[model samples]
Target: MSSVLAKVDWKSQGFRYFPLKLHYQRLFATRVQKISLDGGFTCPNVDGTVAIGGCTFCDNRAFSPSRRVRRDAIQAQIERGITGLRRRYKLEKFIAYFQPATNTYGPLDKLKTLWDTALEDPRIVGLVVGTRPDCVPDEVLDLLDEYAQKTYVSLELGIQTIHDASLHWMNRGHDHAVSMEAMQRVTDRGFEVSLHVMLGLPGETSEMMLQTADQVAKWNPAGVKLHNLYAVERTPLADQVRAGEVRLMELAEYIQILADFIERLPEQIVIERISGDAPPKNLVAPEWCLHKGSIIRSLTDELVRRDSYQGKNCRMQGLPREPS
Candidate 1:
């Protein structure tokens, strides 16, 4: 009998199967590592550029598994993170992931010193900047545009959802159109963009998530991450979850939601991550999805079990997905 996932043809489907880009095999081809660096940058929400308080659900401690969050210097943080990373695996090079409070929410003059210091390190192979859509400006994008010419520069935008109501409920400063414009602007700059979206947000449904994914696919980012919302302890969303004001998605429900999300992509956008990797230590609700590897594996099995793959809809329309 013929099977759908039999060969796991990422190219045949017009989009790389979520499994290919979502898996570790491609992330660390030869056992590379992610060195988390804290640029000590503040957020607009806290700095008075946007809302007084940050997102209701935000607790960056929940993301960025990198251990160098508190390190004072960027070079020290990178070196320490790299040395610590060796305890886990043996990799000569690493992707220095700038994953802290708004990485670009600062003056450009300071940005130069911070970035130049990190690049001076010899072990760093690539750079990944994680920031909010509202944080990055045109000049910063131009800086990244120039950097991409020499090194692999990955810009990750934390766009939790496209639904305005959900954005309001989550306290994300930017709206749907802002996110789209930000993505289009950055994508047009030639620097690779890795978008971050979440599922199971307040007042969001399967349809809303599909809509979010549809819009993200249209942006055609190099990577799209769909994660289920995790309400960390002490966050506003956590209080809501405790008081029954908010809801969480079960692992199975989340898996189904993720599968549906992959179906909506334009077939060319790479599905970098399919779920939020909220560490269990800070996580409060839906503890099951905290284990990223297990969630990914389970999601892969479900996709295969359903006899489906990424871009199932695109291939039907005779549209070829662009290479991400």
Candidate 2:
């Protein structure tokens, strides 16, 4: 198996798996981890500006750390996160990740203040601001563009799926067109863009999920996070799961779907994550998701078995030719 792993130049493969760490190292010349922060942010959808209840499948608390409450001051949380991460990894640097809720859905000055505080940390070399596509306005983009020139600034948008129907079913507040416009503007400005795409929403079939990847390939994101739909407690999705209205994909089924999704993606895109894992205590279904590391290893093994890598099926799907 080690020989099989060696047979492929995983680094050179057009569609590589889990390439973010190496990509960061090439730029920063050091190891970096994301220090997740809760910015005490809220979504317009949940606030009645758009619609209520947020996304059907979303329960932000599912993945948020228990110690980092939303009420904590931004710098206080960062201090704690730095201490925790440094102790665990002996880390030298980190990117402050604004991951909780819709991180940009706030007053412009407040937004600037939160980000400025996080950026003020000496150990934080960059900012990874995660937000909904619809939430990022021209003002937010302007701020992010300025930061991009000074340090490693990345805008992580949750594009979930390219299908409007799926967007609607998920109650994502904005349509696919909104995501397209936001992506175009962000990438055009030369800021590194990373997008979030979910594979197995309730109504999607394997073919439909792969189609989403094809659409993402056209955008040519700098990084992509592939997530599986897992039922979490206290979300409408959980109710649907309980009512037998929706079915989550089995673990093996998700792995195959993920490989197909990755193959359709262009090689230049750094895969930030292959599978999504909710905290075991918060996860309501698909117990297999708890074993994230094992799932990633299984994915690499499957790729080896098939003698395939990220973009082996790209041209076959009518995607742009990989750069020589």
lDDT scores in order: 0.72, 0.78
Write one digit per residue (lDDT tens) for candidate 1, span 97-212: 87878888777876667666776777776678989888789999988877766666789998888899988877777788888778767875656787888888867878888888
Give the CA lDDT, 0 to 100, for residue 41 in model 2.
76
lDDT of 2 by residue, 1-324 (tens): 011111224456443464787667666778999989887777777766787778997784434212333333888888899899888898889888988788877778877787788888898888888889988888889988887777777788999998899999998889988998887777666367789999788778889898888888888777899878888888899999989898888888888988888878766677888777587887888788888888888888777777877877764444432211
| Model 1 lDDT at residue 154 | 81
Error of 1 at 9 (Å): 6.0
Clashing pairs in 2: 14-267, 15-310
Candidate 2 similarity to native, TM-score: 0.89
Best model number under lDDT: 2
Superposed on all Cα atoms, the candidates' RMSDs to the truth, in angstroms, are 5.9, 5.7
